[model samples]
Target: MWRESSNIGRNQTSSYYVDNTLKHSFSNKTTAKQKSNDLKMPQPDEPYYCSQQIQIPPALPDILKQFTKAAIRTQPKDVLGWSAAYFRALANGETPPVKERLEMPVATQKTDTGLTPGLLRILNKQLGPRKTVDLNIIEEKWKDLALPKEQFDELVRIGGFGGTIEWLRYFALGCSALGENITDAMKTVCEILTADPDGGPSRIPFPLFKDLYTYLAKVDGEISQEHINEVTSHLQYYVDKQEGYVQPRNFTSPDCPKLS
Candidate 1:
């Protein structure tokens, strides 16, 4: 009876030990599998897959390079905002808000009205081709530049505009808004239209100046028609001598009637 009891106890202990060993081994394997999953990268055997539908564009590299350079040159205050505008313009086949060159910082306390010569130039390049542009098109371009809606509203009200408008008149109005007075406004227009270098005389074709000036003067409602005729006539002499190019100086000089 003692020998049988000893055998029974030993068998029970052995069975317990075996069960514990198997449980421990299974727990280790489970832990190791979890750790492997945690540490291992997905798809280790094949890092890249060649899919028939996934084709890279050939011009993508150049496009990205240009975008990077534009970002650097533009130095936009709102990265995400400007990027959205840039790509949106690109997709729509409109002029992107890119500066011709990087702008140097100037120390002026004057408030920025969100319109600059460069920005205005971009708008002109975009909308100038058409003699008339729809109000919606103008709004879209304005939004692309991220200009204030209030200013646009003010301009529309100033012109008493409706669905469509003559682009030059609006452009003249834009120049008026840009400058402090009629002369200053005209100067800004000349600068924008001029092919001259920065800080140059900012000469433009006399015919264009006459048209812009005539429109501005008519809107002013203060200048006499005779005075407008007198100014254009005086500038004609210089315009002829200078290969049909009359600069801001021709009319801005004291000899000519004041634009104001």
Candidate 2:
């Protein structure tokens, strides 16, 4: 009796499988019908994927920092103020000054304010010397490839990228020199803080600085510790400035009288 019951159960299972195969064949025909219906559908009165669009905040810190660096490096203090005003205007969703009147994209749009060239020159001084810098290249490459605000803001918290103590010090001094807007330098420091060969926490602190000096020293096939010392000396200047009362520290002078 048990063996007969087991055979009956197996037969039921086989019947179910055969029935499923038939159902699937019918399901494919149903899908085809659904596709045709979809093709013939009328537009809705208010067709939207979602009832409400999501709102994302702009990258305030990165925008502020990069613009500030470009401004200070390219222009005088007065112009830096104008640049700051322009940066604020953009941040607040106002039209910026124009450079031949073009539209800005939602993600990577820029207000011209007619002063971008000046700022670009300053940035170029530090990150340029491009082989063939052109208007299109500046508009497309530099503007487009700049670090997004969030990533840069993250770097400010993480010390900085490329593992260079001197670069970090440069940011510290630049921040201090900028007075109240030193947060700008902090943002810049954050953007590239982890662009080193060994990304994340595994990198040595001063690789870029030391490597740069070494590369320069070996240009004529000979290296020297003098270059290293010079780099060290410059880094020391910034370290000393931290002892003072500045909100963000400045690079210190080696010749100044020692503080008690």
Q: What's the TM-score of each model vs. the native?
A: 0.74, 0.19
Residue-level lDDT tens digits of model 2 in 1-260: 99999999999999999999999999999999999998996978985765357454577668767665644443342554456545655677743322222223222113222223323223333333343333333332223324233433333334333332333232333322222332333323322332334233212234443443343334324434664466455555544553311211221234422111
Superposition error at 256 for model 2 (Å): 10
Q: Cα RMSD (Å) per model?
A: 4.9, 22.5
* The best candidate in terms of TM-score: 1
**What overall lDDT goes with each candidate model?**
0.82, 0.40
CA lDDT, candidate 2, residue 220: 22
Find the 10 residues in a row with the least total lDDT in model 2. Answer: 244-253
| Candidate 2 backbone collisions, by pair | 97-113, 155-190, 156-190, 160-193, 161-192, 161-193, 161-194, 163-205
After superposition of all CA atoms, the RMSD between model 1 and the true structure is 4.9
Give per-residue CA lDDT, model 1, range 1-260, as digits (tens): 99999999999999999999999999999999999999986666856656976788999999889888988876666677778888888998977777777766532313466766666777888888898999888888777767778878888888888898888778888888777778877888998888899989999888889888888888888998898898888888899899999888887888887875
